[model samples]
Target: MDEKENSTEVFFDILIKNEVVMETAPLDEQKEYILPDDDYDFHAYRILLLIRKCGIINEPFFSHFTIYGRGKFSFFDFLIRYPFYLKRVIEIEKKPKLLDNLKLRSFETERALSPMIKYIRGPWDHRYDGIFNYMVSKGLIKVEFTNFNKSKKAMCLTLTELGIQISEQIIKEEPIWVDRMDIINAIFPKNATNERIDDYIRKHFPSLMLGIEGE
Candidate 1:
């Protein structure tokens, strides 16, 4: 298949996998179009990949990664992964009898997942991002609004039944997902723009990007 067909296929694959795309009556020619760009697809790829990678499918219905933008998340990560704070939280959550000890205030809801983030990247020295906060802006997941704590207080959270179900589905299915960014970014390089992205499509998928010309 050609580039146009291939990319459309990929989009449908995502829609089908998530059960978002369903057959509907055909639309007019003008409506049957999508802007051409590697990063356009990359954005979707990153969001889905990050959600799956973070094992959010297994966490509370209010997964922070799903809710907030990269900036907000960076702030939360700063607090949770700070060497001193992360160490303390992980020790509490990682205990063999964590569920049993949930009664104590120390076992507050954030305890369920925040510590795992700490264990992954300790010492509180990681890069910052705003994408995660954007996720929040998109209303993709449940998240606590305030990011910073002058006193560095941890927030409380809980797992709704839906979260618990999703968690189980992830564990049981272990679905295979290819990070489309691997392909998307590879085509566009690390730094590319809408114009550049459009040019590529015009070059490779002529009919798709309105034909390559002033590249």
Candidate 2:
């Protein structure tokens, strides 16, 4: 076996012989470990910034951009959110020109070591609903249902005056996030539907066919 494979097998054999214990705590007992920037206010601010920059995004689109990073959307999310990891991917894949091709700068890529949110679906701590509700309560954003594609109602979030003001202030304070948003625009084509993205992902990452989304 290869050295890496041999080492992995040895590690698993050791793990089988040992019991690992993980510490846990209840909601009330759990202490805050996330940095101040990862707090609710910052999440709210990011939602506002997204709305301001991307225009009115529908629920599905919002989830795709923010929370849904599984299956078809995985690589796109990896590029958009885990930008530092993107550089590593380029290096490992030996696509040195990708860095310049994507117009990623060191300052922008250094903003995150990994994605801030864990992408999952189907009943986890889905932060979008809670944060949207909190923003609604704070009068920072309004949630409205609109007719989409002439058939279905789509729930959309729009920034209120307060949200806009706060988002603008955040933009002024930290413009690096604007570069991050630019990465999103660069990675995904304008008005590209999920089907197109799915097709592209399937073509590029054929292994994902085994674990199809929503299955």
Residue pairs that clash (backbone atoms under 3 angstroms), model 2: none
* CA lDDT scores, all candidates in order: 0.34, 0.54
In candidate 1, clashing pairs total: 15
**How far out, in Å, is residue 134 in model 2?**
1.1
lDDT of 2 by residue, 1-215 (tens): 89999999998888778965456888899987886444667667666765565443445434322222222233443444556655654565575655664556667655743333433221112455677788899988777665433554434556777877887787786565565555455555434444555665455434434444532
Candidate 1 matches the true fold with a TM-score of 0.22
How many clashing pairs per prediction, in order?
15, 0
Q: Pick the candidate with the highest TM-score.
A: 2
CA lDDT of 120 in candidate 2?
A: 29
